[model samples]
Target: MGNFVRIPAGPDQSFDAWIEEPPADRFPGPRPALVVLPEIYNVNEWARGVARRYADAGFVALVPDLFWRLEPGQYLPYTPEAQQKGRDLYARLDVAASTRDIGSALAWLRARADSNGKVGVVGFCLGGQLAFLSGVDATPDAVVSYYGTDLHKFLDRVPQLRAPALLHFGETDTRVPASIAGEIERHKLPEQDLVTVVHPAAPHGFSRTGYEPFHAEADARAFEQTLSLFARTL
Candidate 1:
């Protein structure tokens, strides 16, 4: 319960992160680990609950707030005001810096008390892209992406992702068209460690709990399969 911890980033003009750990009481043994990266909204209750769900299933999960770099204490996509603020902040974000911050989270967890050194990563929306990109450098054993946008376009630069990866997509999601997904599949490495699913009748963010776009059946199925994927490869 007291697992919600904040770790400051580099002292020299760097960002800080708000992270949540799974309930220690749920995990009495050394467990495989994962870093739960939040969507553009940062670490909201949905993301925290999802992290706890993973922890409850015998893995240690940590969620890092990626937006803290541009605005401390700022999380988004809840209030219209917060959403606008997050968009404005994004205009000023240094993507390379945000990527570095993701690396920092991985490094922190690798040596932390709760970690078992075996690591995986999972994320939603923008965070999903980070999860995929991090596989190139974040020291994860596997990665799960929930409708990561623009990822197929970056396959050349992101060609080095070595970990097993799973991607979930909504059939109705225009943000990431089926064509792009096809391109991604075509470019996958020889390991062939990629699985992408298009859930029928689901749209973007269908898995976002408590959101209007949430599709109960699709979310349930997606989550069930996603957990299965992570459980196997994490």
Candidate 2:
């Protein structure tokens, strides 16, 4: 039970966010919120499905269009052409600007009448990288990252991470090899509660429902771990 919401990102700029909220009677009071960052494919049907699933599980979830600056409401389908366009948009993305946009979403969630004021974040692929960045910068209460590509590129920022994080990576995925993932596991920030796991025999997009590399077992287990993290932290 959700709908599209307009979120103000910056001066004269706004983005569309797919917002999902559980039935009010499902719980006695306001519920926790989650900001779901989409992959390079933008906030398509699959991304919206993730928000719906979170809402179904008793959370208020929202997925913002990270590419809003480039194109206000872009939703590219899963196709070769769209992949190129998505990559182009990704290459042109200003991490700092987009992170600010995410910060706006977080503020919006906290101010909602039905929110408990606790917010967590989960992201996949490129969004996964943003989840880590957001944890370090936006300061979400909890962060879950599923196979964030090129995550190692941001290890320098880990020391500043202000929240607990749970990360999953596919063991055989070359995009983020074992060596890089291992480095992340070894690096530690004084009080940062970070957990990293490697999904045995899984690939890059293992958690994606209808993607070519989707791994059902791995996806289910990863999702369970995410839920557990949120339950305990948020």
Candidate 3:
């Protein structure tokens, strides 16, 4: 349902993005685009499936290779060894440069002939953090972050966000406790009106299907909210 395409990132640099487009017969006119940021595992099957899901919902979806600089095309499973490897790569990630890459992806999506020029971003795990940063730096039409770790560190940038944003967290996620959500709510800059949802009993990666920590009810609820946001803003 999706295929990889190269998009220019920086000067003389490019990265692969898994792009999925809606059927033209069903979605006749230009359609809104979505950037599906991946977890630390990179553009794996699950991430590609997410792009396909958005495409099925009448939106053009693209999942960029956020870890290209560290290990191009790296895809890992949910095993403990893979988790450690992902953590190692994440620790060495150049967040500023990666945010620039996200900007490039948004530009590419908007430039597409089938695009309506309104782009939104959705991400998970490490990508979730990037999604929040995209709201502040890339300036997409909408942003959704699911259990984004270390989001408390970026509370100061909340005032700089121009796009409508949604954030989700798991009550049982030690990496992002309820206190973090409370802090985020307290720091909400005026007019931003960003939403933060903490699902009861949901652990980290609650939205990730086929994983041990997946919470189906929470995933469905969050996805519905995300679709609603895109409908209203994008």
Q: Tens-digit lDDT track for model 2 on 1-234? A: 578999987688678999988766875457899999999998899999899889888889999998988876778889999999999999999998888888999999998887888999999998999998999879688999888878778888777777899988998887777566678866766567998888888888888897787999889999999999999988
lDDT per residue for candidate 3 within 18-64, as digits (tens), equals 99999888997689999999888888888888888889999999999
In model 3, residue pairs whose N, Cα or C atoms come closer than 3 Å (at least 3 residues apart or on different chains), thus clashing, are none
lDDT of 1 by residue, 126-204 (tens): 7888888887766688888888867775878545777788888888888776565677777776676787777888888
> Each model's C-alpha lDDT?
0.74, 0.87, 0.89
Clashing pairs in 2: none
- Displacement of residue 110 (Cα, Å) in model 2 is 0.3
Off by over 4 Å in 3: none
In candidate 1, stretches whose alpha carbon ends up further than 4 angstroms from where it belongs are: 11-18, 23-26
Against the true structure, candidate 1 reaches a TM-score of 0.88
- Which parts of model 2 are misplaced by more than 4 Å? none
In order, how many clashes per candidate?
0, 0, 0
Worst 10 residues of 2 by lDDT: 21-30
